[model samples]
Target chain A: MNPLPALAAAASEKATQSGPTLAVSDLRISAKRDRKSVELLRGVSFHVASGETLALVGESGCGKSITSLAVMGLLAPGLSMSGEVALTDAGGRIDLVALSAAERRKLCGRRLGMIFQEPMTSLNPMQRVGDQIAETLTTHGICSRQEAARRAVAMLDRMGIADPGRRALALPHELSGGMRQRVMIAMAMIGEPDLLIADEPTTALDVTVQAQILELIRDLSRERGMATLFISHDLAVVADIADRVAVMYAGEIVETGPIDQVLDAPLHPYTIGLIASRPALSTERRARLSAIFGAVPEPGRRPQGCAFHPRCSLAKPGLCDVGDVPLKRFDGRDVRCLRVGERVQA
Target chain B: MSIANVTSTSDRAPEKVPDARWLGLLKGLWRHRLGRAGCIVLAVLVLVAAGADWLAPHDPTEIYYDYILVAPDSRFWFGTDELGRDIFSRVLFGARVSLQVVAAAVALSLVIGAAVGLISGYAGAWIDNGLMRVMDGLMAFPALVLALAIVAVLGPDLLNAMIAIAVVNTPGFARLVRGETLVVRELDYVQAARAMGASPLRIVARHVWPSVSGNVLVYGSLKASAALITESALSFLGLGVQPPTPSWGYMLATGMQYTQAWWMSIFPGLAIFLTVLGLNLIGDAARDVIDPRTQR
Candidate 1:
């Protein structure tokens, strides 16, 4: 009664519509062979608002890449997906999952652009870098071929490439790995898509190039007010760029919160383990970086109850491992832990 | 934007830069003197094939009874075959038939084999197994034996022999491009194409085909050489270029019986040997030039 009502009203006024630019709901991906099916992603969901960067952070096999692929509708052959992905804009919203492959393709590289982890092999080696970027523009009917070329050169220049006009004529192989990655970014962002999905974009690069690439992505996203669904396994890198973070474990997002709160005060055991594992100034010199014990379970072999139970230090034998622990909110943050700022009723 | 230590690379010489790279690939080929020699041999063969009619000193089939089996006299150069046909003239004209047969075999294998390779490698699984099995079955028999059997069935003639040789060699090309495509299809660039919203057809045409074509063409050249040798074997067996056409193999077959007429067999055998050698050299050189892994 003191000030809560006024704060709530201000929140509503600040965001007249709290809806997201892209919403992915309850995505489940599996592969089937001979009557046996193995789940890759289990009911993963998240929303990305305009001008917000939401990072999906997980170790390998935690289904981060699969989720990104599912969102892009580029899941490899033999994998099947069931979900809903809505892309919203000023023109209104369209269900990405409901669209036919042809329609989804039309939206891809136009409304939704994506960059991959391997900058080394992400571009066609035979095509000139400028032509490759122009191809994306021409395919989307974004501009005339000549206009596309001019824009491609301009985009390269904006990426801080020296002699952008001459560099545009170079092949992917002729360029350094960092330069090639910049070319890839130009190709993806030239469309100025509403949503940009960068799946571990800097994983293949060295540390310095990594920072440069991250800065480029951050600047470009801010300039375009583009929403991003960034996927990575590196918690330190994620901390540097992501505004909000969703930590996944064994095909499910186990925790989610704003970056500051999540990094400063992690709720789920897994998130705590991730933040602890990052090498920091305060970390003891000889002490090993803390790591979550054991491994993410293979699909079809995920432990029952809390998928993270096998290695979770706070796991209550009878409760945490008894059944699937669905994500729920506590203290205005999402978590899947059995005990997180909660008292046992018994 | 600092690019960090990525600078100073220009003086270091990048690992992948092809030396003397130019659109014509002339510098690359000329780097190896043997390859240049091979190119010269092929050029000469083409000129001889094209001008066979004007180059022959006499009608190839002319039975010069007056100079029957003479031993390399300038008056009747390369002596004469058992039928008194001008051995020199027949050898000259034989170049035309050899080149035509090789050309036809190469064309057939190039189209049919490349298409099969693309489908098998790209489609994969059962389609891959099924198409590859048919190729395996064809490859099971020794090329010459299979070509001979096919000639026996189609009723021996130059065209039948060429068709048989084409059939025999198609499997090699299919396997070559299929292996190449399997590697290419999994490359990240391929997935990038899909992410670019390229349709399956566009991805295949624009991405898959170009990367695979270079190796396929290289393999095609080697297969052409094999076809030429196989055609010679067929003609030697009376299954190709029926007599009086003056094919090198046919000339050698009859020339072998006349021990006193040494020039009878020597000239035709030299022609066949040189043509096959020329082809092998060109193919090997092309492979070296196009595949960076093989470059020095």
Candidate 2:
């Protein structure tokens, strides 16, 4: 028997459906190894409203991907999460963290969908691309197999893939990297979810394909009025796609604001460093790109107080290293730094 | 308009076309010299076995007193045995028997082993440990001895012999599938499938199964050759196929006593050798064809 409709209905009945499509509040994930506890994500909070795009930007190992996985309820075993991950939609409000794995799964690919970073390896090599997309529909008991097949082809066409019917018969390996990512997009969007979490969806593609993919994602999200939680390490890519951007460093978000504000007038020291390191078309020839001094600290070995203090060019020894730097709200942004007003260039 | 075009394009001919990938595999197999030879030899053997009823000159069990112990000649072909039965006819029938046992034993082991391995690997942690330990226990005994013990318990018969060989070979397939499944279950596609709300069962069937099927098919072909040897050993020991059924193993066993005749042992041994060679060659060729790195 089909269980999704009833299950989703039951979940949506618990709370009012008025807030953001996804609201992750104070979500923390930690694990214990050899009697030592390592907190992977320390009290992270964010929200993505309908038709809005929120980019989670960070360097590698800064808990950006882990945050996305946490929201999907797909964290690796041994990592435990706490706090509210409320998902509100037409169905109703449901705390994803509160639901059992089985219940969370029922909501996935139905109310929420996700695309991954590596388009090359993200699709099943053995399955036809069309069948793979159709499977998402069938898994949620959304339609019959034949209908799913027809819709799959239609979705492929909508993704700007040429000859949708013929391409549908092609296996993942037979498709190009751009085509495969498009297939992934088709698969994710076919469910017409309220929220779509894309984890570095264009990191593996060339510049041309990356632009195309970003445009496709932007257009589709806008058309569907879908909330998008886009994760990426490239400030340039995030600039073109994200409405708002959250910068994470060593498991904590140091700055978050509307994209234009954060890009034009960044507040946090880490965010400033990221923007300085970025290469722009207008940069003078052979001018050296600025870089943040230190790598993102490992989760287990993160520095006490402010995690970014070690790498911050604006760091003051006594003030930055000895106290917790809370995420403070100003006029248009939240900056997690003790010296938010300082004009020191990274 | 595009949606209608797509719907109509699919509706025009909804039937599935033959997969080009399979056609390419066959072409690749034909290009490999040893693979081609193996295919030809197995095809001939299968034809010989299938047409045994019309092809055999005389009843395999018929006793001709005048022709008893005759050497190779025009009338009796590979000549007559001590019991005056045609050796050629018996060998042909033995081919049929050996192929049947190999098919049954391999299929049975593959089903059980693949299922066990998939479940054990996909449901990791304690279940993986427990199931693998059991498989290790089964593999501890020498294969032939294990088959012998199984035959002893189940009683001496063709079906029991197949069962014995299957049980003896189950651990090999289980280990291979478990190893492949372990790698496959961690791939990005599998993780993507999970994010798409695919359950454990669906993920295993759709993602893990296809990824590992090539390895399983190659392994199964290799196992068939081993199963052939085991089936012969069981029948040679008089625990399989029974007398008067004209099994190659039994013929070889009985023929060993007639050292002077020589043809008795020579012909049956040739059949086993050729069949095993064909299966091994096919297995090697299949491995080359199915592996992407090996493809041109």
Candidate 3:
């Protein structure tokens, strides 16, 4: 019998007592179209401790966003999800998967808050930005509308918007892109949620604004002791704000560890490729950024042994394509690759 | 997170006066010549209608038998009718009846239809299908025929005529608002509202309603003119306001029988034409002003 399951079970038992703010285990999501079925997410699992940010990194269509949405109970209709999603709320561990739709909705924007990808579209154009932020607080009955409105302005000021009182009165279109993102952050953070899900919050902003938004997220998470599940395709951005990183491929997490360790000495070939693909300031002029050879395989078409095997440089033909390859513990991190033992020896 | 960070990059954009959307629409309407003309004509019509008691030279019901069928002359600017009553005074009183029916009918349809559309569109699947199918059924019949049937069943009177017009127009408003709601419901802000745990009712009221209101306002103005035409048609058919009320359509009906007395038909006919023209112009201008695609 593999000892990994036993070890993980023991750890999770302790996790339930008082550790991670959010813990998702063996989550599987599948979709049905007529007689055919497709697995969108396969046994995805991760945990985020209080005051720590766990970045789920992957290219587009690799289910990074899906994992976050699943955690938040915001998956689209026609998709089915199963397995345990344990959320630690006010010293109690509630299995979110067991909650009804209305019960789940009550927890959202109260115990948990999410910031979407598009800042421009995430806000109601007709409403004042301050009212939008205040809505989060009033929605959960945390405070009266009048009190919520005042706190919303204070939150906006904390987000670094100048003349926040007047700015609060400004509609979504009146604010700049960066300011809009700050407002989004303020909206998500206003409830003072225990778990914050930021799904590529800075992807639409300018580079300078991107850095500032990342800093704001980090500082706020630290200040509030909030556990953040940060989803991003950008490795550089993940390295900047995330304490830990999980690299996903074809709907499954392939490698996960401390951010520095994953970036500097990646174990999985996919992680290695991801870190290598980032454009660096030191690269020679005209040199093309290295990228993973092929796109992430569609759910139903993924290869047998490992989803990344077809694009992996270190993949051996017969072994890598033979059968299911399980995630194994390796050097204080988890990695899913057949040749990790050989790579480590070398 | 410091207070100093707030001032460091504040005021990047120039601090100009905040502009309201409706103010922009008003400015746009004023800039267009036809819109300005429509505004003036409608303003005068409303004033005349409101002050009909004071404005008319003679009492609408009072008879002046000595000057029967007189042409447009010094005493009667619009001439006298078959009853020997001043046509000018009758037409002024007719404005009051016409404006009252049109305003009440349009307001009823706008309120009821907009509410139905909003609820149906936001709550998709069976509710949407069921509500929309009912609206479609209502719209299937010709608007005039439907209004006539309603008036016939409800008993012919000014109130019954207004109700018939409102019922006929409800389908149009419902269909328009439903379409707008379907589009607005899928927008990201709405999804953001859902993510924030907003109740369905709150989302519909606060988010969905505001986005579709501009289109509703434009459509309502356009429908208001149609309601006026319907009200006039009902009165002309003798199924509307009873005699002594001085409705434009009733006056037109009475005047048509006396072909030799040209002043009788011409004055009432001119009132109907001018009011309809003013309303149509205002509707057209409102559509252009509210429609973002047409903005200069």
Candidate 4:
């Protein structure tokens, strides 16, 4: 058995015996527009064993961010959702998708926390950064204003924010992009939630800041023993952070397995294409950077059968065009491809 | 992790505090010549209106038959009206009436309209459509004409006039607030608040309302000026503040009957014109100062 899968299986077994921190199964989301409904997420499923980081990696419009939003119950109006987003917190297992908006709100910030993409825009401009953090604490009834403010400052200090007391009073605009993102992290982690969803958290920051924020997330997740759902478009970034990686294409997860296996021996063509497209400094100078041909298919115009058939290099002309391939497990990895089980020598 | 970390950490000790932009904005208004002048004029008018009872040398309604139509003098400053009432004293008192009506009407309109607009704009869907359609229907009627119609129905009285002016101004304030609410509702902070598990009401109160207040406040000031003019117009038409009471518009109306008597018309007309002009200037300045987009 491969070491990565063995590690993942061991982790899963450990979590199964101890209980999962969060489990989302068969989560589907559809959006309606102009009297027509479009499926945004089609039976997407994943779970985060306690203290494990699960990365949902895909190009933009592949529903990676949508999955995080769905998990958080932050989907916008006109979108219909189904399936279970279950959390096994101290309160016991509860289906988040079935909860009322108020009940969902109660869970949010208390049990399930989120750090958004753009820290600059995600924070209220008129409010002081400290007050914003305090608001989260007070909203969840975790503490009084005075206690929340005190905790907020301490949290900011812990997040490596300089002069936490004074910086607390500063507006989001006053802080640097990195500092603002740090404040966002501080706010999200203030409650020490069981599940923390970081939706493209480092996408807007500089490379140095991105590394810092990623390290911060990693360190904090480990310290709190929280299950992290880290969503990102950069496969390289996810490779370092995720224990398991779920590669999505056309709103469906095309492959999901241990990060090392998915990166080293990707079974799905989409995953292979994504992996190969990463520019490598170690490769030959004459080797052109591989790129997936064509943009992501528009939601309503997604192709039938295998969604990646149009762009798949290994596609069989007749078979790939004819039948939809359901995700099937092979060697402990789930791949949605017809040739995964077949021994076709490349 | 080294001495570089220690010095780097020390370098972070007291980052310069960014200047408060809103406070800077207020300072800009204070420095602006036109805005300052406007503010001074408004302050003087407000003081005069507030202290009218103590400032007026004579009871505005108390008449002196022998001194009727007397020209400007040390005793009867702006002169006397046809009824031998001190026009200066009456004009001072008229400032009180006009100012009171404007303040009351604007306050009432802002409270009612802002609540309605916030509900309509934020709630959206059928609630937005229904409330906005009603506002549109109300706005279709000319502001002054609507006030006149309402006053006529309610029977001409000071309270009726104030209520009429407030009712007429309500839709304008509602529309202004609703437009602002719609714009503010889409702001990222509002969306963030919503995503952070804030209820719709909490989002509106904490995130939406604060941002929209500056716009609403500036517009509300302008609306007060409009209400003032409308109240004056109603009084000028003999449909507002009865004859015995001191009203700038009433004074102007009665004063104009005697075309030969210039002081009769000039003093009250000038008072009304200056007050309205001062309010408009202040309102214009406020709009520029509160909205950064308008700043040069």
Candidate 5:
């Protein structure tokens, strides 16, 4: 190993756990597409408290994106959703799902901010960068227009955009990809939103910009005391920024624990396979990276028992593939496997 | 990393030339020969229409009974109509009427059509269907027949002619805008605006409107060209402007009686042709530049 992963794993483990969790429980979403009502998420649950980063990692189509959207109340119309996404406020913890969209959107205004995968298109191309930031501020009634413009420049200045005053006047199409991503981050975090959901925020940037942006997010989380649900497919990224990590497969969280515990001593076979699949340092020249056997199944056709059993190495003939496998305790964390102990011991 | 950590050479590049916006639009037009020619022709027509009062040698409606059926000469240029009105002066003033009819009808239709389109597109399945069906009913009629019916009910007057053409043009705008709105409303920036506590009105005004502007400009010019031709037809049918007004269509009607003079009908007819041709060229050029999918 090159030692970065080991170093990152240790740092994430050392990060402390804090107050009340952003507490998601029993979330379900189904949508009617192609004349079929597919259950996209099945009783998915996890939490991230203020001052904590929970990395929700999984492959494409594994319900990680759906879960974050549900938390933010941004699921597309015609989808059926049922779940409790509770966040603590001065009024006390309230379930976001129980509220109307307009009502939930009110909470989203001052409290929630989300950054998505493509920053290039997230800001309107016709709008000036300063005005775009000022719009969010003015729309929320946070400040006067003049003040918003001034603050926008200051915010851009802080975001490391040189000569923020001039840059603010330029249209979004005038900016580069990484510069636009920085603009997006400034817009999302400008009001110091309480719950920051970053769904693969750095996935589109170059490697160096990715590192810088990730560092910026981590720094923001630390300074703002905001609860963050960092969703990603990149394990190395999760190892660096996440305090806790949850591995999702087939609409359910199959494994979760402290980053060091989950990544170093993973109890679930899928998690083991995922970490093993990384192209890491090895003396064996041109060695092939390990990969999980099969792709994640489409929503409606998910197999019985453990969702990963078909691709899992430690799957037993009857116990692992016969029925639903509920999450159970192992190694001071949760793992959804009946043969986790048997497989690990062997 | 703060200011000094920013190395311009290593950062992402923005592929653009920093041209002033209005200048950029003009430059783009200049690059296309068809667009430039269309703009020049249209500009000359507008200038003539605006300056007709000062430029014309004779009053468009001034009667010269002695010059009735007279041929083109130094005394009565473009000859004289059977009513003894100067055909050249009438043709010059007719530019004003053509521009007014097209401009008013296009403006009215764009506002009404865009509003209907945006609301219908945003209203979802059943509501959208209901609004679109009503528009479809309007569209089902042969355009000229429907315009004639509207003009007949409103009476054969100038304002009524503009209104009739506007009503005829509304359905086209509504359909274009609605189709565009359906795609634009789903853009990420629009959704992001919604996430920021922006009401439906704000999102539509800020995000949706701007994206569809290029479509609106191209289609508006196209509809304006059609409306000018429709106005001439309505006037020719004696259902537009009125008899005394020096409209090109009315001029054409008078010109028919003095076909021997030829200049009476020919000049006005030529004026109408060139005006419509200019508008059409402008529309084609705008569509080519604005609608990316149609570009070569």
Candidate 6:
């Protein structure tokens, strides 16, 4: 069964028909200069069923952040985007790509919330932590200042921040790195958005704080029934929280499947390489960890045929160098490789 | 729900423990000797400017012919200028003009420069390139020469001189603010604000602006001293406050005609020098205090 069609049909057939909370199809994004344009996201497509979590995993410059920014309509001015981001809910299915900036802003922070990567620099240094969170609540017309403050305090408490009442008045600088991350989570969840985009949410945090933040995100997401697009470079983190995972390389998705399947048996060579590269506990202390040779292909100068051919250890002598391999279904998973047809088992 | 309730109870125990950093910053500022001195000086200057009339011993412009160019005496510690005007009275009144022009000019430049800089730095691409190019063109001209040209165009007066000085100073501030804004805009907080769905205006106002304001203020204070010097230059050239007004610059200009009357020019020039020197010292101290990277 094709997951796309099944999900789409399921989304349409529901009596409530609140539509797919966030959907992007064949989305393409590029950054342009005077005479050159570098494609950052090429034909990437995904959807988040209402209250489900979808993770986009990739290394730096793999277009994860760009994809999230595209969803938020917050791409920098030099970059041009062409795609469809459709959002449907109690209001109706509206194409987000075509909306005016003002209209998009109205939907943002209210219907769609985002948790950024770094907590240290993500907050206003001069403003109190409570005011920053309150600003979100008030901007979207969700609650009054008094109500927002009360809610902010509660949200902070829920995130395991100590002394929510007192800490609410503190500036961002006054808080520890972990506390700041909690404040960020609280601010994002205050509006109770239908969809939440957490881009590298735990990347900048300590291991303990990272675990706490991830747990808080999971618990809160479950409670609110919020559809989330979790973007991260760490495969381990994604495996823990993501319902489904999309592995990206350069600017395209190489493989996607349920988290367990993707983690246990990856189809794409890049995914296999990634899993092999990690330092597993079963490996001996003196063993040299496996690493994928060669960097990800540059955006503008990507090699002909397969973009990963230059780095794939299992690349067929002639087949990998000749033509582009479109994403195809294999063992109920999406894999883009000429070798997918071969009889190989993990 | 019961688990959450239990967690809340556990969380409440930590509420009594206070964060030491918040209290430390306040105490640190209070104990900083230079910062305290700078604050006191700024406050006194503000108060003196506010009550110039009550502070002056005599009419600033009244010509005392009987005591023409008198040396420092019991009645007139600062002596008299070439016009026989009490130099002490004129200097006190001159504080009102000097401080007012500096304050007003600095404010105007800050508003104009900050807006331009924030937009240029935050919104990169052709917009940033274009704004920077324009700023470069303005900066290419010498500061004093640009001010002189502006004064020449608008015609000479103290207010016009201030306006000219402000225009000349604007590019420096714009460049400074733009550079800082670029760095601050890339900060995680700015990215967080954007993710939170803050409009460009709101992000700049809340996230970007506050981070850069401290730096801008230090630059503005330094520029105010430059503006004071510029105003004096224009006045000495007969392009600022006219005669019978008793401006420090005017007194210096009048003293030039009297080769033997050294007291006339010396006192006023010294006042101008000391004021600028004090402002520069304070600006340096402010830079050290506000910028964490510079603080030891």
Measured by TM-score, the strongest candidate is 4
Error of 5 at B232 (Å): 0.9
DockQ of each: 0.41, 0.35, 0.37, 0.38, 0.35, 0.36
Cα error of candidate 4 at position A84, Å: 1.9
DockQ of 4: 0.38
TM-score of 4: 0.92
The TM-score of candidate 6's chain A against the true chain A comes to 0.93
Query: lDDT per residue, candidate 3, B103-163, as tens digits?
Result: 9999999998998899888887888899888888889998888888999999999999999
lDDT of 4 by residue, B55-117 (tens): 999999999999999999999999999999999999999988999899999999888898899
* Pick by lDDT: 2 or 5, better one: 2
Clashes of each: 1, 0, 0, 0, 1, 5
Q: Write model 2 residue lDDT over A234-271, tens digit each, in one string.
A: 98899898888899988899998778778888888788
Assess every candidate by TM-score.
0.90, 0.91, 0.90, 0.92, 0.92, 0.89
lDDT of 3 by residue, A20-77 (tens): 8899999999988666889989999888877778899998988899888888887877
| Candidate 2 residue pairs in backbone clash | none
Q: Which ten residues in a row have the lowest lDDT in candidate 4 chain B?
A: B1-10
lDDT of 5 by residue, B1-296 (tens): 33223224212422112224335445555565787787888898899899999988899889988878788899778888887878788888999998999899999989999999999987668978988998899999988899999999988899999999999999999999999999988888887787666778888898898788777887888788899889988999989888777899888876787567778788988988888777777777777665546655
lDDT of 4 by residue, A195-254 (tens): 999988898998887888888898898788888999999886887788888899988999
Give the best candidate by lDDT: 2
The TM-score between candidate 6 and the true structure equals 0.89
Model 2, B1-296: lDDT tens digits are 22112223223322211234466556667877888998898999999999999999999989999988899899889988989999999999989999999999999999999999999989989998998999899999999999999999999999999999999889898999999999998899999998989999999998898778778988998999999999999999999889899888888898999999999888999999999999999888878887746644
Question: lDDT scores for all predictions?
Answer: 0.83, 0.86, 0.85, 0.83, 0.82, 0.79
True contacts kept of 1: 0.40
TM-score of chain B of each: 0.90, 0.91, 0.91, 0.90, 0.90, 0.85
Q: Is candidate 1 or candidate 5 better by TM-score?
A: 5
